[model samples]
Target chain A: MELQGIYILWLRDLKRYIRARSRIIGSLGMPIFFLAFFGMGFRRVEIPSLPQNITYIDFLAPGIVSMVVLFTSTFSGISIVWDRQFGFLREIMVAPISRTTISLGRNLGGATTALIQGLIMIALSFLIGFKPSINGLLFAFVFMFLIAVAFTGIGIAISTFMHDIHGFQIVINFFVFPIFLLSGALFPISELPKFVATLALFDPLTYGVDGMRWAMIGYSEFNPLYDLAALLIFCVTIVFVSAALFSKMEVE
Target chain B: MEPIVVKNLTKTFNGFKAVDSINFTVKKGEIFGLLGPNGAGKTTTIKMLVTLLKPSSGEAKVAGYDVVKQPNMVRKNIGIVFQEPTLDLELTAKENLDFHARLYGLNKKRREERIKEVLKLVDLYDKANLQVKKFSGGMQRRLEIARGLLHFPKVLFLDEPTLGLDAQTRRKIWDYIIEMKEREDVTIILTTHYIEEADKLCDRVAIIDKGKIIALDDPENLKKMVGEDVVSLTVNDPERLIDELALEEIRKIVRIEDRLELSVVKGEIMIPRMVEIAQKVGVEVKSVSLRKPTLEDVFIHLTGREIREESGKNAFWRR
Candidate 1:
């Protein structure tokens, strides 16, 4: 019974993601544009902090993939606000299932879509002459999924407290940009000043991007094991917190 | 045990008492109504009974399960159609029902069968594959009603089921509600400000005002309390006509602007006598009409105010 509730919620999200053809296409435009402009525009530039013979495209590819996951997963929380506004959330809240199951189902559903978006980013990177080792693709997949799960949990957690969709857009934009920028998705955090590097250490996406970089291009500042552990902790904590908050949510 | 039982259930928002302590019960397979104008706590009481909101004091049970202590059990036994549209517009009608069925833990065969049965019951089977966004307002409401009954719950709570629909559509929805009650054999609790809706669809109604139930009885009996019939006459010099036409058959007479409303037994029999008395007193009778006492008259008699005065403004706010 519990599993069925989770599966149903997940399926609903998947169906919605598929049915909104314009949204799926529109959401991909920004990440791909970033990949092309940043990769080609800075292809000739070099930094002495780089490790060995990795090209700019190879370095920017994994970051772009992580960015796709981060943006899609965090933005998925807006659906909860929409559900609240449109009255669909009450239908789920009034159901007999536990809120933990409901939250888990929604988190997993958002993560799955985010994972798909990341995978599509990876595929699209190949068109721009980006390359990664064949054996490391599996590890890259794992890091990408962890990134998706962690941020989707963040999105759901934020959405449970928000009642207005327009207000949520303003708030999530404020959070998403800072987290993405500070996580070194656009540049190397090692080149930053002492205080900024320390701040980067606090961002969960720093580990996620570092892990993906190590998997996709064999270049990373932090240890892959440390990155994996941080993401796992973030995923578990956010999932539990969102579930607790959702259980206490009231509908009028 | 009854399908629903309440003992002094109440809810307060901050210092404001939205739903004061009130008690009522609903029998098995009965169509009970909570009738009131806006801000009268009808929605609040329904929310508490459906386990959506916890009461501030007292207790209530739905389908034999305590609402506060056993919310999951209460939720499992009851179905609700909220006042607003709750359907997922992106999903097809079938997909929406399928999602609901899965959440309720219905298996493959039963889900398919019940989905077909309910869609057909609400006359939406032909549009089952279409996305709900494409449906008109009346069709969407019908689909919601169909979805609410998909689980065949022991109790169904419909909050303003026919609200905001045209008169023809409202009547059609009423027919479906009545038909579903008989065919499904489930207890129904509906809230509405529409007097005709309560009178036509409910087996009994609890008329609420300002967080309290002012009256509770079958429509016929409640209207009977006002009088058997009411004779409304617009005559020249209504004050003099009132003084001259004092009869034992006329139970009460109240004068509004340019009209005298007489509460009487057998209003048809009293109308001719009233006209004759007005003629004898040299008072020219401009208009005379005889009709049975409606629930509106009862509401006015008890509250000393028209329900429509408050409801008309509230209806605009709802949109």
Candidate 2:
């Protein structure tokens, strides 16, 4: 029953995303712009410890894909706010299924949408001279999915308390921009001051960015195990918290 | 088996008892209504029965399953058309029904057949592929009903199903609803403030107020309890008119704004005498209208105030 629910709901979200041509076109604009300007502006720059063969765009490409996942997944919470306002959430909540099932469906659905956004960005980056082996692409898929799950969980958790869509966006943006900036998606965490670097260790996105960097550009500041462990732990924690929070959402 | 049973069911929201201890039992295959003004806990009561809200105290069962302890079982037997619009506006009508069916774990073959059946029931089969946002308000509501019936639930909950629709649309929806009940053999629990709707559609009604069930009976019996047609008099001077019209032996007189509503068994016979009294008292009778005794009169007889007055003006389309 739960498997079917998650499948159907996940399909529903994907179907909606596919149908909303404006949304697909609109959400892609920021990530593509960041890749273009940032990648182009920093093209010649190279970090000292990074391999000499790696260009700035190559370094930024995987991080940009992770950025797409972060923004898209967190923004997926907007659907919950909308579902509440439009009354669809009530239908789902009142169904025979458990709240955990409902939350899992929604989380997986949101994460899938975010992963698709990541894939699109990765493909776009590939066209603009960002190259990776098939093996790297496969691993990037896993890392992007993990990142998607974590942020989607964050999004759903935030949305449970937000009655207004405007308030939801304002709050999610509070998470999205900071998580992007502080996670060293735009720059290396190695260059940060001591306290800021310490904070980066706590930012879940930092692990995602480092994982992506390792996968795509063959660079790593820490053992890949740390990234995998940290992201998995964060993903599970967020999912648990989101499922608990979503159970308490009132119909009215 | 009885489709629904409630005993001392109550729900409190932050200490405000939204659904006070209410007891009722609904026979199978009946159109039951929770009729009241807004905030009278009609919606709250339905929420509890549908397993959307938990009772703060007491017990209820739907489809022979306890609502609190076996909410999933209760939900399995019931479908709800919420007071708010629950359809996915972005999706087509068919997709909405299809998704809801899948959520209920309907297999593909049964899902397809039920979708076609329900859509045809609501006469929305032709517009199955249209986006719900593009559909008229009435069509959207009908689609919602179709979605609710997708899984063939044993009990269907219509929470103000006809709210915010025009009279014509409401009537059409009512016809579809009755048709649904008969065709599907589903027990329906409806909540409505429209006295006429409760009178026309509900086999039995429980009039609620301030989180309590004030009266429960078939519409005929409840109206018999009041047993008076409502004669509303818009007079130039109501205070003087009431004093002069004392000979009519009015059962109840509720003064609302500039209108005086008099309850009497023979409103048709009394209007002429009321007019004569108005002339005798030198108060110009602005307008006089006689209405048959309805659930509204029953409500006014019990509550001392008109139900329509305090209810929010959210349904501006009511007229």
Tens-place lDDT per residue, model 1, B30-122, is 999999888899999999999888899999999999999999999888889999889999999999999999888889999999999999989
Q: Which portions of model 2 show Cα errors greater than 4 Å?
A: B316-319
- Give the local distance difference test score of model 2: 0.86
- Across A1-252, the per-residue lDDT of candidate 1 in tens digits comes to 499999999999999999988998899899899999999899888956786598888988898899999999987755788898888998998999999899889998999999998998899999988998878989989988888888888888888778787676576568888898889887889888999999999999999999999998889988999999998898889888888887777777
Q: Show model 1 residue runs off by greater than 4 Å.
A: B233-248, B253-261, B268-288, B312-319
lDDT, residue A40, model 1 = 88
Q: What's the distance in Å from true for residue A60, model 1?
A: 1.1
Candidate 2 per-residue lDDT, tens place, A1-252, comes to 588888888888988888988988798898888988988887888776667887888888878888889988988855788888777888888878888888888899999999988888888888887877668777778889999999989989988888877786567467778889888888888888889989888999999998888887778777878998999999999999999999877765
- Note the residue pairs that clash in candidate 1: none
**If you score just chain A, what TM-score does every candidate get?**
0.97, 0.96
Docking class of 2: high
TM-score of 1: 0.94
- In model 2, what is the error at residue B34, expressed in angstroms? 1.5
